[model samples]
Target: MKKTQWFDFQNFFYKPSLTSSIKPRPFTAYSFVPFSPLAMLDPTILTIGGIVLGIAIIERILERWGVIDLVDQFSKIMRFILPVTFYGALFYFFATFML
Candidate 1:
């Protein structure tokens, strides 16, 4: 009895097929409409206006409910003081190290 190779596997793997279903399509790179920067303005205004409006609404509700009065004045004073102290420290560090 004798054994024989049925096919060349290398040629079968590398060769392109005649009945290939994949084909690249032509693409257009032009458009009829022009672009504008004004398109971005509405969304920017909407987001900023929404944040400001939300803050205003919350402040108004707090004022109406007298919640602001319930908070001690010292805590309100420290809110501004703490950030100022942090900014001063940051400025001092940057001035000493960066300059």
Candidate 2:
């Protein structure tokens, strides 16, 4: 037979002992430990990293084929055209629907 002990009222009021092995730590923003890769394992960061890697690989291929100049020229034209197109679309959308 197993031994049973009665619960004591004094045990309920007792606090953690100072000589205990476990220590309390301060709260931190990140749940992961410091310098851990899990801290930077967010989906958004992973997506951005993948996009940067893809761009770098494409740039290398373009450079190897000597077609980087074409991309540079196209990017220059796009720099001017994209903002105008975006604003024109925004203005038309606002005029037609947003009032």
Candidate 3:
């Protein structure tokens, strides 16, 4: 009787070559080292946070100036602009990375 191992060590590190039928997954390039602290930071999240903070500051300033109508108008414009910009970014990411 032959004994079998539970883990298949043979195929553990198997990576398909370029000439093989199996296609490899796309890897996004990062400028910084993954192990370092900087790897924890994502620029996209930071950019969005900064934009929100800026809007908050502007809203406060407008409120102090008694320009509530202008703030309301700006928000209405942002309602349409934000979604279009977000979807455009989503499409760009899928087109650039997934395909």
Candidate 4:
């Protein structure tokens, strides 16, 4: 039966107080815009790639010097290794702690 403040539209239409306009915003601060880094290396991927690349380089040198060709069969094996290692570790951690 009463027009309470919850649905009162008249009170909502308020003018800004003169004191608020004169008050300084002490906590006003500038925001920072982040920039992209030059090189973003994934530790696991890059380490694996580096090891593979090193083996490739060594094979190249050995072939040039006539020693051994190195175990060159598993060059692209990281596709399997990376996923298995990451997911296996994740599953292991989840199973160990969560379940």
Candidate 5:
């Protein structure tokens, strides 16, 4: 017996080339508005600094209210973790916004 040829295959295939005759709309010319680097710098710095300052203030408030003492058993571990987490978050926010 002879094997059937693969070229005999058929299916519901759509051809994109059928729309090749249509042309796309031309782009319009517009004025170029230059970005002010100083404007971008000020807000980004303020946001990152505000976040860090807010974290520090909250931590101090919690410590003053004896909250830290309540967790005395893990005080040392928390002291280490707090700054690292705050700074990491600050840096991440700054880097993301800058990009």
Candidate 6:
């Protein structure tokens, strides 16, 4: 046979210490940390990295086809357009759907 113990009122008021994963850590101002590929695991950063690689591949293909000037022009056009498009979509989503 098992006996049931009564819960203490003091225990009800107590809070357990949070684990590191449960609580967010504070970042230091101007703290320098060595770059690690694991730290760059954000989806947005990965997407941008993929887009840059794709652009490089396309540029190489254009050069291979004897369209060297087109490659440069395409690179210049993409360098300016990609960031604007990325940020514009980001803000549009934040404003329209998120808000």
Where's the lowest-lDDT run of ten residues in candidate 2?
90-99
Instruction: Specify the highest-lDDT model's number.
Output: 6
* Tens-digit lDDT string for candidate 4 (1-99): 987657346655674454654666678766473423323243554565676567667657766776543434433554556577667655654454421
Off by over 4 Å in 4: 1-40, 68-99
lDDT of each: 0.59, 0.62, 0.68, 0.55, 0.62, 0.72
Q: Write the per-residue lDDT of candidate 6 for residues 1-99, one digit (tens) a residue.
A: 899888777875685646555667897777365444454465665677687779878988999999989998998998897888678656654454421
lDDT of 2 by residue, 65-98 (tens): 9997976865676577556655665565445442
Candidate 3, 1-99: lDDT as tens digits? 899767466765575455878779999987664354543255664576577668767877997899999888878877876777667655654454421
What digit string (tens of lDDT, one per residue) describes model 5 on residues 1-99?
Answer: 999655322432443344567689899987574543564456655766686567667667777888877446455655776678668766765576542
Candidate 5 Cα lDDT to native: 0.62
Which residue runs of candidate 6 sit more than 4 Å off their true CA positions?
1-37, 78-99
**What TM-score would each prediction reach against the true structure?**
0.30, 0.37, 0.41, 0.32, 0.32, 0.41
**In angstroms, how far off is 91's CA in candidate 2?**
30
Off by over 4 Å in 3: 1-57
Clashing pairs in 3: none
Clashing pairs in 2: none
Clashes of each: 0, 0, 0, 0, 0, 0
Q: Candidate 3: TM-score?
A: 0.41
lDDT of 1: 0.59
Model 1: number of backbone collisions: 0
Q: Write the per-residue lDDT of candidate 1 for residues 21-99, one digit (tens) a residue.
A: 9788998898554544454355544555565556556656767778876334534655775566556655654454421
Report the Cα lDDT for residue 66, model 4. Answer: 64
Which 10-residue span in candidate 4 carries the lowest summed lDDT?
Answer: 33-42
